[model samples]
Target chain A: MAKKSEPQKASPKSLDVSELMRDNDQPNFLNQMQEDFKKMMIDKQVLQKCIETFLDEIIDQLTLGIIFDLHRKFKTKAYCLEVKENEEEADAEQSEELPLSPVKSSPQKCVCPNCAQQVAALRFARHLAKCMGLSNNSRSSRNASRRAATNKEKGASSSSSYSANSDDDNDEDWNPRMNRKKDKSFSPKKKGTPKRSSEPDLAEAINTDTGETDEAKNLRHTRSNSSSPDSLSGSGNITPKKRDKFKKMGKGKERSSASTSLKFD
Target chain B: MSGKPENANGRVSMHLDVNNGLERVTELIETRLIESGWKDRVKLACREAITENNQNVPSVDHLIEVITPKARALVPDAVKRELLHEIEMIFSNIEKGGYTTTLDG
Candidate 1:
């Protein structure tokens, strides 16, 4: 039996060598190789999936390009214009409207609801404050009384007889509280006169009612009373007094010429 | 035949649409781009475009306006050459496969 086993197993040493070779190629080694292959497959699948996501992102961008090109080329003109407007809207940075108060120009007129008169918008608030008899009422009335007193004192101080006539004429034109009897008196005095004797009576009425002083009107009244015969004889010549006033007011040469033209007219 | 002489560009485009040839060409182009790593480059370019648009998802039209030219320029020279060669071969094959007579008719 031993001899038969020896013949079948080839020599014992040869058997030992064959068994060692079989041991080297064991199930554990094959199992590890199989596990490594499986791991490699899983890693490859994950990488492929990641690459797919990148491909999808690029494809999506390409689709956008395709759609854009198609729409730009084939869309109707109105549709294209609309798309363009929409794109402009999107590209525009979102600007929230500020919760700010409205600003108005200095020369704009606002109609006063109470008086039904057009007032400069900038002064409308103060006008309204006066109408409402606000906290500034006493101070404003005091200032107006002081102005009227100064004007009366100036009129009285003038020694010339024409000064009194000029004062009476100015008071008739400027006094807001005067009745229609005084208004009727103004026209008869200005009758057949080439002068602007009734100039801006309505504006003076408004100025006096609002307790506002018009220096220009006062200066014109003073000039009429104080005009020398030589100055008044020349039609378009500026009086020395007017030239000095213009110079002190920092007005240009054109204004002096314009004022001279006004006097002649 | 349609009263206007057919331009070379028109003829080529007509042939490209025959027998799903355009689809096959598209497949070849996709494969070439994948093989040449152009797909990855395009993805990176797309990412750059998205970032440049203030990281806001850009409108499709705007994205097209921004990326199409760049993608065209970013295509590798070798891939472009191969694609051109493949298209030429497809044209030659169509000409030789007795389809040209039908196309001319």
Candidate 2:
């Protein structure tokens, strides 16, 4: 391991440059920097070709080895079945042991490598709101302000003077017609903005008050609205005024009321 | 090719009168066939039979030791030889015609 560590050292200046690239001030600067690095790494085109050819051969050999392994697996089917069974048993054990609540708890780690932000559960809601281009909508003014602060010092390049989306100018200019198509595609002339054809499906509120079955109340007071009867402890939330509305109805009527609007019932 | 029995040309069988009047009539069909210029065809068939499945094809020694006696007991040696040759020819036909290739443009 000590012997392997001999060539591990890199110039500190390169590290400093990489850190600067990650500093968020230069967003598209990473592209130009990578191009420069590639040029420096391969001064000769012939040398680059040779390296690429060597890499391709190595990749070919690796793929051939994998294919051969798969062929052997096909020949012995029993072993593969055993491996599948083992994986299933492992999954069962993990589920039985952990039983994690699906809900987000506390500040979870963000998947983005650089940001490493402590993301609260509300962050998902905020992110969804942002994705709708709600930045200028004023409701999420705080998030928009935060984005502007981070994006303003974004690109130190002279090209930064232009609008933020100017970076996409290359694509827009490549095919001028494409820009028109993109504009048309982005702000699609939604031929028919589907009007909420029905109120319940859109609002997702099945009138639990409708599945009236006095017999069902006698059989099991647990409302068929939710599978887990422990929740929905009270019925005041649905209509606020209606009580024991579904007093007497058949299973079909019960199912219709239960699923009239799946989002909420 | 060895013995020219008197009825060799006319008849496709031969009766060998052995000791104590025990007579054995061997079918001369294969001998007649070999005489009829099918040697090259027979050799080609044997080669193809072997090539078709070298893994399953019995060696000559195994054929003579194990297979020939059984065939001889079931049928006359000469007829058995012809049948074996015919079986080999069938396998040879498959081996020769089964494979194909595409022409490059």
> Number of clashes in every candidate structure?
0, 10
Quote the B-chain TM-score, candidate 2.
0.26
lDDT of 1 by residue, A1-265 (tens): 4323433443311323223224533324223323432342346444344333333333444545444544444333444476588888866644322222244323678987744557788888987665434535663453345346545655677646765755664464333234335335767535323223323343344335433434554555467755543222222345568645533343333345545666674
Worst lDDT window (10 residues) for model 1 chain B? B1-10
At residue B41, give the lDDT of candidate 1.
73
Off by over 4 Å in 1: A1-265, B3-10, B53-55, B100-105
lDDT of 2 by residue, B1-105 (tens): 111122211101111111111111112333443464443343333334334654554345433343323322333345444544543333234234531121111
Against the native chain B, each candidate's TM-score is 0.74, 0.26
RMSD of each: 25.3, 41.1
True contacts kept of each: 0.03, 0.00
> How does candidate 2 fare on TM-score?
0.16
